[model samples]
Target: MLGYGGTSSPDDPTLEAFKYQKMLADRNVILSSCGIEIESGEKAHLVGHDFSAIFSSTIVFYYPQVALTCTLMSAPHSPPGRKMDLDVMEEITERELGFEFTAYRPFLLRDDSWQLIDAHKESLLQSCRGLTRNGSRTSCLRDA
Candidate 1:
């Protein structure tokens, strides 16, 4: 979520750093859509299942006592700043990574990010589908 949301946008306002205030508004809207009050999730045990971990963790950063605890599934909670916002996956991973990390390519905040997203969409969706399908499919299927 580094290139996806708030995260110190006021100090460094850019389209890539989506506004925190706007994010809060959208969160409330989602809660409203689900018939939940804006404050109903306060002090709740939050769960983050991947990149959305930023959303879960940001709530805690804004309000330290907001969530009782957070369980991050795939991605770790990023530090509460945009200091490393401009670093791409290739540069960062090249330092310590011993192998290729293909999954991160699409989210490098590049102009062609949309194209990469499009390329990975089927695999991503298929991964989600495989999980929801509960063993019905063993892997992401390549489109014929």
Candidate 2:
């Protein structure tokens, strides 16, 4: 599970989809929606995939420092060991450049500054997409 956060705006799945496609090119990470839209007499409702609902809730309580980095959470399916966890993160991170995966110490940005976080995230995503587009098979557990 890879998590992200932004104060710029609420979660926009459509916009996020484009960004995700541009960033996470690994075929494993599949982002989709399973909600409904209802329009009533004088009101409307738009519901989609709530990433928080599925994302690990312990991020805030367990890894507070992650709140500042471009990365919010990264939960990998390894053999229940620190080394395996590092291996998985490294493999996925290798798809993109400039990502130093150190458990929860992702330093994609400086000091939780939201100014460049989105751009950084997009750049990384674009690079990840390029890897797959260039015919390399770097697999993530979340791949489609």
Candidate 3:
């Protein structure tokens, strides 16, 4: 949450809060600050997509009390298998798909990517609302 937009600046203290194991407590602090009160037996429900899913599961693993329910979108929960960084995954992806993912391009590195994100926002909302391409509701949502 520290690195996420509008949160604390990316300084040493914030960086420390973002550490994997420490994030559970930090999340509680943030929630408390926001006037959220999770009852003793209540678990936080987490929703995540793509890379965020990793953080969601890891948080659940480190502190089951913090959260146990997760709804992951598009990308499934990919539990860590081995030590493979983005570079390694990029190579493997190129080999399999004959193309590079957008993260590699300095093209989408900063605010330059905002337009793309905005363009997809509506479709993303539709998928979340379980709407089909015809603007009809469906049991399962899929982008057209």
Candidate 4:
């Protein structure tokens, strides 16, 4: 999880949190456009077929960091492991959007000093699925 601390803004302590939320939403669009069956309001299950052509293709195009981060997670340090977990969460995005996999980096802003924040990886994954499902439900209702 990426956490942004040291923000001087009294009005936007949650700005980073909201930014990542939008990132997850954007990732969902990429997945749906790739032909994944992400229905609204349902938990996404990674099926074996999902691991085959569509998902594999999506991962190949959009989630290269999965392998890299997984490898790094297996390394002998806490920092690398945390980084790896972040990558893994990003991979879930690839699964959701059947896109070609790619590496992901958090957007960093420059302040007076270089401040690092944490990304909530689990929340990202959960929110993506939730948003996708919610969209699906809205569409279905509209159709009905």
Candidate 5:
């Protein structure tokens, strides 16, 4: 499953990205407290051959600045790296997107799927109050 964790510092744009990393680590620690198994790996030297594994998958603690647009107005604290690292991360994300798209397909309500809607209408209405407030936003909902 893909999970998204937002940082607590959205109100402070000036906060360093590493703070979010720390929050993720803290969350992992909490999970460990709840008996989840997690790897407590040591930091590898950026300039050494051992650091090559970072290219495989991005550790949550590390957000590559190259993933974002840079300009004269950009923040000055970005890590120094070859342009190649950004390219690697982009490729990885593109590959991951293939699975992400497929995972969402089963959740999508298709035009033909409206047949199931009327049968489930009462339960749907009772559970989804937002649907009443917003009305049916999709063609399937309106058609049903």
Candidate 6:
């Protein structure tokens, strides 16, 4: 299970205390319902541990055309790293979505390390145009 809680303003001790109290109450309900015994302040610690474990497994997929990003972490063998080179990912997107490929910049590291991948600009553009005309709803609706 995954959970999130936070104190919005750490600078204000009163506000932080109030937020922590609320979190404690909410966590108590969850723990009791789940039949779990957690000591005082342990709810926050458990939540933090669970959150970190889940976040480390997360994968983010970026779609430029729709200006959308999706995070997925449920699957095994997902990439693990701070960043990924998705230059060739545009090709995969084009093929899977039946869209044309357009211009795309390859991923470059700060130290000048580059992944050698051909970016097909024209194909990407065609795919984007097709997607625009059809819209994501109609095109990918069958797959869902």
TM-score between model 2 and native: 0.24
Residue-pair clash count for candidate 6: 10
Per-candidate count of clashing residue pairs (backbone under 3 Å) = 0, 9, 0, 21, 0, 10
Give TM per candidate. Answer: 0.51, 0.24, 0.56, 0.20, 0.22, 0.23
TM-score quality measure for candidate 6: 0.23
Displacement of residue 47 (Cα, Å) in model 5 is 27
Select the stronger candidate by lDDT from 2 and 6: 6
Instruction: Give the clash count for model 3.
Output: 0
lDDT of each: 0.58, 0.36, 0.59, 0.37, 0.38, 0.38
Residue 88 local lDDT, model 2: 71
Error of 3 at 37 (Å): 4.6
lDDT of 4 at 120: 53
**1-144 per-residue lDDT for model 4 (tens digits):** 123344333356667534534544554565468664334522232221311333333432344442222212212323211334656744674578543132313332334223222345554445445566464332222112
Minimum summed lDDT over a 10-residue window in model 5 is located at: 66-75
Superposed model 1: Cα runs more than 4 Å off: 1-17, 40-43, 85-92, 100-103, 106-144
Candidate 6 lDDT tens digits, 1-144: 322234343445355433434544554577668765454323222312323433323312221122123333422333445453355655675777665332222222222322121255554445445666564433233211
lDDT of 1 at 88: 65
Arrange candidates, best lDDT first: 3, 1, 6, 5, 4, 2
Itemize residue pairs with steric clashes in candidate 6. Answer: 99-127, 100-123, 100-124, 100-126, 100-127, 101-123, 101-124, 101-125, 102-124, 102-125
After superposition, candidate 6 runs with Cα above 4 Å error: 1-77, 100-134, 137-144
For candidate 6, give the lDDT: 0.38
Candidate 1, residue 59: lDDT? 74
- lDDT: which is higher, 2 or 5? 5
Q: Pick the candidate with the highest lDDT.
A: 3
Cα deviation in Å at residue 50, candidate 6?
18
Estimate the lDDT of model 1.
0.58
Candidate 2 local lDDT, 1-144, one digit each (tens): 233552234356666643433333321223222221111112112112334322222332333332332222233322212344556766677657434334223443346644554657765465457656442232222211
